[model samples]
Target: MEALNLLESFVRSAEAGSFSAAARRLGITPAAVSKNVARLESQLGVRLFQRSTRQVTLTDSGEQFFQQVSGPFSTLRDAFASASQDAGKPAGVLKVSLALAFGREYLVPLLGEFLARYPAIVPDWHFENRPVDLIQDGFDAAIGGGIELTEGVVARELVNTHIIVTASPAYMKGRPVPAHPDDLAVLDGIVRRSGPTGRLRAYTLRNQAGDEAQVAQCTRMVFDDPEAMAHAAMLGYGVALLPTTHAAKWLESGALMRLLPGWHADNGPVSVYYPSKKLLPPKTRVFIDFVVDAFRDREFAARFGAP
Candidate 1:
């Protein structure tokens, strides 16, 4: 009945991408949701969503309006809940998306412990390499590198996901040890393809001293997953640039040797991303904190890279 109610319906519908979903969330009918949105659109003298049989998408102006209003509206809701002390127990499905290798090697081990701490929470997690649209997909959180920060999402740093150049010891037995980053251009390179963009990743190396060198990687073999690429390097395929966190285990077992140890590619921080600060559910909030605390200290440091 109120203008704010109409706007709330509009925001929920836009983010959910359908009137029926918004109605389900609001405990109303799809017709009611449509009417509220239509009334709001008439008052504003602008179309907010382009309705289709498949999905509802925002117009350009509606996108801008959502950006401006969503954060504050979420904050208002949070404030009301806090005032009423109704931000109660965190229960229900806590859906998460994570990188395949990182989830397998790191997050999976901690799941039992996390569930023990929050028995009310149900773990609904997906492991994949590509970036996930947290808001659109209705996930509580997603973790890994190369997370593009969108308006309704935020990233908390989990670890520095820097990369190192490495190769199998057998591959280096007869070859001249690279004295500098440039010498690696002569060695065979096993490269990785970008999961998000599907382009071959280039070798870009940097050191603590801030010197930078980039090589247009010539691929002897190509793989999409980092763990797979690391396996290729360990089998004496060629020198490969890999995330130290991912490569640390093989390097420790002497399956691979860090080459030009001083040089590394500063890719980016592995971050745990969530919906937004204002509307952060307790399930999402605690999980984010749990992950950061788990990895921030020494999990990957002594063998992996500088913490």
Candidate 2:
């Protein structure tokens, strides 16, 4: 099939009367728009535009091609719009990947209300610790911190993410609580191993005043997932640095307490990502909006300590 982007470039350039104008409409550079139109011209073996120093005007062959392509293209666009309207009803298996602990603690609970609103949408959520190839793996969306941005994938920021060193009351009993980063050197540490990198994750702890210090790990055990590390700390394993989203509930319940209340490890934003912005199916779109609203309602960015 012919590249639709090439056709878009040609048609947009034709309508807008300039490559720069077309580029603005298409969210690309003028050079890129010109290049796409040029490629399309090469593929069709016809000169499409008469380019002057100031502006571009369609050639006779280009005008004829546009006339032939425009009507059917308009109809196709209308058909797509109609189909998109139908897709808006939210009836499909909504496959999404999410961080394990956050999903279990936060997102999974929101499903009842979400499903009540969009009954046709099935929640096929995959919760894991590491990032997945959202495009190659056919995932509808992914929610987590530190997701790498890629072409055609759009990430909407949901909340700020941070890691805090915490331990259970039982574990902290009779043990001197760490007063500083250097104090952690004497404490038994539960460290996390990155699934993708296979390296022990070390965090630079920071205070509200922007002072930074490297955490010294005296690891008694290594866990891959945040929940695992948190569990280990609760089981009296050691003090663990964990995402505040995962540790928040426990901290509230007294299962975990902050080691240094002033300091936290910033992990950047937790975002909900989809493949593209154009013509999103209803299920994925609603979930993205729903999660954003939920996080807003809770003011999760501030609650998670990265705000």
RMSD of each: 4.9, 10.3
* Separate clash counts for every candidate: 0, 0
Error of 1 at 296 (Å): 2.8
TM-score of each: 0.75, 0.71
lDDT of 2: 0.83
Cα lDDT tens digits, model 2, 1-307, are 3487788789878877899878865679999999999999999999999998789999999999999996565456434543755444766678899888788888988999999998878788998877876755557899987778887688999988788989888889999988889899888999999988899998999888988999998988888888888888888888999988888888888888888988988778889998874556667778899999989997876778742
Candidate 2 accuracy as TM-score = 0.71
- Candidate 2: residue pairs that collide: none
**Local accuracy of candidate 1 as per-residue lDDT tens digits, 113-203:** 8899888788988998788888766678999888789987888887776788889999999999997888877899888888668898886
Top-TM-score candidate index: 1
